[model samples]
Target chain A: MGGPGNAKIEVVLVDDDALVTRTLSFLFAGEDAFSVQLFNDPVAALRHLEQHPAHVVVADYLMPGMDGLQFLSKVRELHPESSRIVLTGYADKDAAIRAINEVGLYHFLEKPWRNEELLLVLRRAGERALLLAELARRTEDMAAFREKLFRALL
Target chain B: MTDAPGIPDPCRALFSAHADPAAVLDPARTIREQNAAARASFGEAAGRPCWAVHFGRETPCPPCRAGEVLQEGNALRWMMERADPAGPAAPPGVWEVTLVPVRDAAGRVTHLVELLRDVTLTLGLERHLIELARGLDLEIARRTAEAEQLAGRARELQAAIEQLREEQADLLRTERMAALGRIVAGVAHEIHTPLGAILSSLELVRARLAAGRTDGLNELIDLLQEASERIRKVVQTLRAFSRLDAAPVERVDLREGIESSLALLAHEMHPRVAVERAYGPLPKVRCRPDEVNQVFLNILRNGVQAIRGQGTITVRSFAEGGVAVIEIENTGPEIPEEDRERIFEAGFTTKPRGEGTGWGLAICRRIVREHGGEIEARSAPGRGATFRITLPIEGPL
Candidate 1:
């Protein structure tokens, strides 16, 4: 929702570890024409994010506040148009599985992620998020038109 | 001439010298003649039947040898009893009598002579031999019965020993199986956390190296090392525990066994319950290592379950009365006083169905008893529960 003149992509990173957030923020900072927000606490990130929903959310699996999967699920509800990326060390299989089915994840990021791999995943997620947002806008426009047309007919 | 037996004078002298009563009778059994010995024993017998003079019977005695002697014209012998003294009602003594018949030239039986001999002493000895034979038979029968009873008692002893051995083997098998289940679950949880951390650390390091940020590189490596080290400890402890199941009996440091069991359960319990150890110096206990390990596992598992979520578990070990003593105390809701007594009773369960709770404490009791040890539970409502196990340091009893 930033002005059309400022057409930069929006990305959000949430994790329990401050180091992971700082490192991931640095990794995504190079001239990709995108804005990155890092949150060490998922609760704080969610409160700020409700007012300004991001295009893509990258979250850690195990955290002191909430699990990665639960946070992403919450993100899916609040920012319906955002793409979800799940980060996990995969201590167990169920975490990954839940991230996919429960959180409706867009991508799986294994620990020790490569630079190129993360970027490629983020690029794809940005495009998908844009398309979903456009579709939602169109659906709302059509609903408003139907309501107005019905009132005029009356 | 002897066979002729006409009662000649020389034959009469021999009959008299025989020292036995003698008589001569015609075929009609009339006492036609009598010797001096017969006259002395029977008074007058001339012109009287032999039966009338000797037995005082009206006719000849039945089974009389006179008839046999007359018909066969041969000497015949018989035994009879007669009152020769004619005193008071005296018992008649036994006699051996022979009837000899005399015949004419035509071999006709004309007269018969009879002689009687007493044989009481020989008959008395035969009676004595029969009584001795009966007593020997009774002794043989009594000894045979005694031997049979002893054999039956030995068989009973053997059967009792066999039953005891079977019970011991069954208890050991159940305890071993329970230990394996608990170890498997604890290992899974223990391995999971470290593996997760290792994966995350490696991922972050890999991302940093691509961007040429060498700063804090050593810290990332250290995290990876620490995570893997945690995982390696779990593996080492599990391997040591697996080795114990194969050894039926061994000298075990009580502390090592308690630590091994705690490590296996630490994964699930670490997040839920706080643990503190107060181990003291102890002797090596001789026991079935796996079974002893099982006792510790069951008690610890119960302790973990008693704590719903946020509680403390304290494990203490010491030596008392020549026994290795272990105490596991939990700061959970205290068990009721009534439940404390029955905690180790078989088939007693407070856990809901499908939780596998009933046999946990019971199996612990069995293992301890089999090793010549003791286990007891003490608790007051809302205070907490403590299980005390005392095992003899000596070999299995």
Candidate 2:
């Protein structure tokens, strides 16, 4: 269930396991504000996002084609405003830290995750995206105002 | 205000009297006067444009501070390279220049006075000092690299010397073992023939006494015969030990060596302890019979000493791959893991100081290695210990 109204936050889930993807999709489907898109192939997910950007991206750390960090870096290059989260079976603290530091990851979830925790994190990420969108709009308005004042004075 | 400032009137006199190279020029870029020192320093062309006479250039230099002073009506001081015709064909000489503005009575700029002094020698000395510093840095680097190389060579030499010392120790051990073997073989061979004769004569005397029906004499003769046979067996064991050095290469039966070792230690074995042999059909391995028996004896003795009460020592042997394997397991307190690796090293023993010299295992390891073999021990804390020896079948007998 996305939402009753027209405003809905799109979330893209990228993992190599189909069962994991299905389980996460079902869990997110229970939320009203989220519309989940599942992709087992990271490359396909990246290609889909190039055409249709998502509000948030949740990826697996280990994948066949590309790893979670590499995928996040590519996603950041394509859409710098997208929030990225990594879900992994192994809790490699060093890799997680590196991923967060290098690629600007939003959060990380270890395997055997609870549905409530995943939903909570996604909700927080959606709220952050909303705040960033608002900030961007405000910056644009300020720039326009500054330009008009400069023209009148010059 | 009617008179020109600081230097116009007084500098003309100062310039003529100065010993160092000097020049005076007005703001219009024309040289007004040259001192004797300047004439000697720059040669001809005394009264021309300052740029042409000093720089050998027909045009004023770009962003010229001298020109800026004329336009802005301010004083300026800078250094420039002036062409020196009387000097060697090196680069131009360095000159310190000072510009001063002259005002008229109505407070208006009238003319500019410029004074020049040569400073080429000082700059040349500074360059020489920089070059000397660079040379010193290279020399220090070269010495440091040489010292490092020398240290590396010393380390290599130390390693080679240690290897040579180890080889010398091994050669000495081999020589001692070889000499002991020859001496034992000679003594055993000398005793064997006479002991055999004594045993035969004792048997003859016992036969005669039993036939003649002498009861007391028969018992004495029987005791003598048994003692003679015991001596003969001792001689046989000694001979076997001696033959280890000269034994020809052959596929030796390990079961025989183990049996002979047991027989040699039979008198020392306690009645409370039982010795068991679980031997398989092992292929004949190329080895020295006496040396292998010595290895078995040393391990068996260690096992017997380890057990204070009733215990069992099992000697097992089998062939696998291209090697012969023998395992001697004892039912006693196991060796600590920390001591297992160290027990095989030289001068390591658990026995009381005088009871054992700590050379038994060291010798055993040497002999085993000489035959291209390896021996290792395994033990748990509370369980018993096991020593396994694996010998390459293709090694020397």
Candidate 3:
């Protein structure tokens, strides 16, 4: 078992509702293995993402500045390895499908979520990030080996 | 080549090298040397009559160009529109065929060279252009229809906006009246307390003077007491008028409120008009009491004003199904159906300008709405008008 100290997962939460963000922040505050950062403005969160990357990004669907899908698309372009999740009040299937196809989101959660279910999803997302990091490292090693072989043959 | 009499070397090569089905025939309607193109065009029909190859018939085609060339020895070109008789697989197509006469050494027109070209692809392209033009016309029609519908919708929206503006103006007028009513009610309440004390003191002074046998002083006290009571009545009237702007909800005894309204309108009553009351057991209603009284006063005043000669106005009240129902009926000329709904509107009145403000029924409606009650007037022409008010009763006790 990996201890909380050894496995520190950081997540960024973006939503227009202050109450929802604060509640989610409180829920994550008690966990040792996770760190949560809350942002009411999606644009500000996106600016923060450019400087400081997170293991996972959770966002709300309907917002004033930039909708959840557009924000997720930008996040994917900026940090393709980060896990993305969408929380929405409206059951918009078209938006959800676009997010899946364009942003490659890991999960979608509706509003008024259960604390345990959200935490579990985040934990799973963290594990997925770890696996992706390992896969990228292996791919880089394989590319370098192929370059050496080509040089030796030349 | 034995002086191949009439065939040009380049034209013969063209006929030989061309891949499409082609043919050459003589003016005598007989086959000449069929080139490779002609062999592929008419497989087993080579060496047959030219008309047999073209029309698939035993005889020559009518108005044959080859025959015309043979007669005049001149080059002839023409187009033909004809259906192929060679079954379903035979593509019906237009052909542009030309004929050039070949003369002998004696200058006699002998053979005619016939050349045929298929124009199916070009004709199909023309047909496609026509279909495209038709589709574009349909698209234009649809767009025009959509634009017309949008224009109609815009006009409807404009009319709706104008109507809304009129309604908003009426609401503003009603709000101004409500504000004034509130101010009057507050001022009346403020004066009533002091007026009540003054009247009590005057009565005490009258009693003392009368006991001491001062007759003149007793008359003065009586005058003062009477003036004070009159002021008190005015204050009460003002209070009732202000209640029209009272806060939306409060407990009110419906019967008592109705009686107070009748008392307030007593001064407006004419000698020819008689007031009758049929008070019934009514429960307290949850409403703005002053507003409810205003509704009663307005209807009663209208009823009294409607009668030209002697008339009686009857007021009735009762409770039913957790609601207080009040009716004011008059024995005056009835309102017409066409004018019934318009009567409640501000600035609408059958009475002449000076006799009616026309705002009375409108104000009554606004007050009733604020109390969450309904007021309706029912009448037939010459049957007299009856106004009914229903207010929800407060919970038991």
Candidate 4:
């Protein structure tokens, strides 16, 4: 839960089926702690991601043109700090796990997923994304402070 | 001397008392003397050549035993066959002839005594025994040939039984594969999509109720109803399709079976191929609905695959003349003219290796034929390929 001072967790959901994306969008609704965007086309989603940064990206494994792995890999290149998750309808869990490891994705989810579990995973990924951003800001501030000290000593 | 005059003085009584037809021949083969029995059989043949008297020949009888006896200076015997000299109607007779060489005191062969006898009866019995043995040998050969023929038939029957066992095993395996193929395709898209929708929709309703807010409750309930209905229809179709083997026979609406098959294959057709159904009034056909459903699945799947990217599949059904008919047509590349009929042959495939078993169309034809139906393929160069199936309403006899 987020209060007025807390920032909303930004998320993007991608799937070829409009119904699936729509259903996922509803799952994140009425929650002040999360902000969700949906796409039925991986290419279109990639275009949107180039202009706007999302903290967490969730994609379906089976899409017509570009699959989840390819799309998530592209997302990684665009934003390394963003958490990438894959959703698969396949019955084989081993395959899903292998895909996650092969692509260095954040997590793997199955279709017809329990809502509570899905939310928990997405929340954790969002937290990680916020932590990485905060660490990068701290490192930049520390470097600037050290540069100032070196100038003063000279 | 008292019996006959001019006999040799050394053995005169012994030569005259011999009972068998006997004669004495000089070294030149001239008959020198004849005993009483010899004279009775030959009728004063003491001066005639012996071969002329017995065999009525111009030359000495071949292999003359008396001649050999004289040349070798030893006793010899032989069998001879000739016509009976008594009359023309008398049966041919055989004889055993013997020649005895007599030597003087100086060891010179002075004469040879020739002996003969009638042996026709003995030879006739021997010949009859040989004929009976030959007949028995022929009978044994015939019985051996008959036994071999029976064994050949037994071997053929055993081979037929082995072939039947193999075919039954193949049927069981292929049936399981068909079921698995349906499950994979349906589960991936049709049921899972609706299930995902239902689960999330229920969660939203539960959260709202827990929060004591009834604002969007009716809309969520509506979503739940729609999603569940779709799942129910898919489940019903699957259950009916799989239960066909247990039922054995059923009077079913042909259109409904075709619709169920289409439902199972809906995932393959979406977002790429367009499906058009031109169903007409059809009569209920008595058949094994499950097997018939498989036929539809094979054809529809084939239709989906034949299209390279985007195309239309048209399915038509109707009844005419107590026969239900279905025509499935695809707007894709036409099948080659030569492969129209051969596509239904077992082990015939156009797909790449490991992608096709070549049994799909073959099995389809078999199932259709088992229900007293006919299946055929037609294709023109530009129009595309069409499969036409017709089933008799009365069922197989």
Candidate 5:
């Protein structure tokens, strides 16, 4: 995606099937408002997040080696501010319930998903990520202000 | 008195020798002579008065034909029913009496002959015949009453059959309308998905055209064709599923009915409900497949309506007790205890006014019962509701 502003929203999408992510990437690529990264391997996506964390992480639930639930659980621990969404062909109620309660999933969209539904969920996640980032920045500013006030008292 | 005749003594002897129960009486009503038969019947009256010997009366009997004949100088005959002193068990008998006047050659009444004849057996047979005729009258009356009762029962059975036919016709109409409503909703939802994709692709095409770009036109046309094809198939499938034909009753797999119904409901149900199947091996059911599938659709709709939000629906089919049983369980609101009894009754609805006419379950029950099958709802007040339908594999009972 091309954008003149360097402060655009960053989104990372991971799925075992490369075709799904490739087709889905075009939906975000058409917009100048987002910088979307696609990966077929969850480990590679996880490594990238360690160095440079994204605001929203998308995953498939029925992946090999590491499922969407486990991967999102790790994402929750690594970057609490990022919003997690699972997109998969398998639609199991128990699995959906577990994902919501244990992994703190934001949305569960079944495959053959419509473009509007995906856009609606990703837009909501982006708003939440922006709110959390602003809150974290204010906390850092408050901590630095407190350190300065202690030095002045000394 | 035996020799008081103006004629000879030989006439008196001939009168006494008569074999009939006869006796000779003088004008003063005294017995002159009696034949042997008369002595045997009246206890050997030789010189006693006629009344004293035959009737054992102190006075002359009233309506005496003997005195009348003596006055008229003619013979007389009389009939009467009287009890016989001879046989106690014998019924009352009729007696024919004759009073004959004996005259001399000088036109003078000499004697009166009283003939005694026993006619008890003839009277007994006549009485028996009358009694038999009365009995025959009563038997005819009883048979007529039985025939009337049978005719009344036949009329009632005919009325009951007519009522069942009317109810069946009403159920068919209501189910078809309900099915149409559901299929319409599904069609709307299914067509919306592809329409959304087509609209989004058109937006891309418009943007590319403004940028003077034609590289992705082929892919865009392909997407449009694919989406339009989806719309066509959805319409075609709905047409096939809803085609109305003559009722073709046959043996078919029970699972096929369930699957077809689920496919019709997939567009509406997949997003809202998670359906679980635990189907066991079941025998082919003898039924009209289209009607049975309609029942399946109604039951699924019932479960969906009960659930508030997201719910689980479990469907199971198996053979039990020479019947094919299909059970559908819903994680929705439980039906109350009082409602279960009248749930299948016509026009009985638990849903609010416009949302439900209360015909779905009733129609389902009717269809099942007409196929020699039964449908029942089992649920605790809050544990959720399950509908079980059992159908015979042979035919309608």
Candidate 6:
């Protein structure tokens, strides 16, 4: 789990094609605020996410064993605070949009996407995930403090 | 018989001289006089009743014209059928009877002259003509029915040919649409992957430039050049594939066309399928270059789809005996015995519905035949399938 500014944003990128995943990882290499993990298979990515939680999970929409949406939906169950993003081709734009609305996904990035837009969107998603994690920690802290006060009163 | 009469000698002479059987009847319907012929025919009946002597009846026969002739004071004629007097065992004989009334000077009918002629021979001829006409009518009816049946069969054959034509057109359209879909999908992946690499590498270079770092600049440019070359090759091959308005026939290196097809379909066959090529020295063959490329593409795509997890596709080309021969073999499952021959037929497919149009090989066979070439498939149970195509060195004259 990542917190506010200056904390490293853990990013997990999943795609069946190695060329796609490799270039995406290179895109985030220069930014010190982001750390990216790459997986060529969606099933393997899901298995990795079980133990190593990510702040932002980026997935390609088309894969052989499991599609990006099914993988990301399972990611949501594993880590509700992790912001999800999907990569799609121009031909599947309509299906990707529907997936965004149906799965409550954060956003969809089209293939051959501009580097600047991709970086900006991932940056924002990471910040949002960090804020949600912070909020959840504060809520837990508040509950624990209330329980202590009630016990002291008893 | 001529001299014996109850009348004048002139009338008796005339009646006796007549060739036909003639009899004179009194007002009481009895025979009053008989000529020599009547005496011979009726056995000398002079006082017997006229009806009993002529018709062998107990009384006057029905449809008698005697009363009508007497009242009208004229002659009457009618047709009748009776036993043949010449041969009693023969069929009935027809007769025409004539009754003439004899009157006195006061204009009152007093007697009737009955004449009988042997007309059975003329009636027999008339009956034979009527029977021939009836037989002609039956023959005409049979011929008309036969003509109708032939026309019906011709119509059914025509309809069957029309349906086959429609099915052929439908298969052609479906095949064209399927080819277009495949081109769109494969082209998108081939171009988009390299373009993404080039752009992303450019972004990394810009970031390094902004940071004033000069290291690894050559590697970045190398990546850019490599990606650009790939795009350039894809475009060039695509241009070759789109030569729709070019010359219909050209002397082409068949190997180049095969390479172009393999380049366009590289994205679909990579990583899972290995391609091995063995090209022998060959002369240029005259063919439609674009159409030949399409054939290679379709066959290669089929080879790729046949293999499940991983397999190898082998392509070999050589020239022999004034012909160019190309063989493509894949290490996939063997084609069934029943489907080997029918695979080239239109609308025959093993792929599940919606995945194949079943006209790939059908189109291939047609295009080859158009160029005066031959295409065939061979396979055994354990061995894989191989498609062999041969084209004449010089196209159809």
- Please give the ranking of all candidate structures by TM-score, highest first, separated by commas: 6, 4, 5, 1, 3, 2
Q: What is the TM-score of each candidate against the true structure?
A: 0.50, 0.43, 0.44, 0.62, 0.51, 0.73
Give a tens-digit lDDT track for model 6, residues B228-264: 8877887888877755546778888888888878877
Name the candidate, 1 or 6, with the larger TM-score value: 6
The C-alpha stretches of model 2 lying farther than 4 A from their native spots are A1-154, B1-215, B244-248, B270-272
Interface RMSD of each: 6.0, 41.3, 31.1, 2.6, 9.9, 3.0
Give a tens-digit lDDT track for model 3, residues B286-366. Answer: 876666666776687688668766778888888888778899999889898888889988778899754465777877887
Single out the weakest 10-residue window by summed lDDT for candidate 6 chain A. Answer: A87-96
lDDT on C-alpha atoms for all candidate structures: 0.74, 0.69, 0.69, 0.79, 0.75, 0.80
Please state the error at residue A115 of candidate 2 in Å.
99
Error of 3 at A80 (Å): 99
Question: How much of the true A–B contact set does each candidate keep?
Answer: 0.01, 0.00, 0.00, 0.41, 0.03, 0.30
DockQ of 5: 0.03
User: Which residue pairs come into collision in candidate 3?
Assistant: none
Give interface RMSD (Å), model 2.
41.3
Candidate with top TM-score is 6
DockQ of each: 0.06, 0.00, 0.00, 0.28, 0.03, 0.28
What candidate 1 gets wrong by more than 4 Å, as runs, is A1-154, B1-164, B167-171, B192-227, B239-253, B280-291, B306-312, B321-323, B330-385, B391-397
Better of 4 and 5 by lDDT: 4
CA lDDT, candidate 1, residue B344: 76
Provide the lDDT at B207 for model 6: 82
Candidate topping lDDT: 6
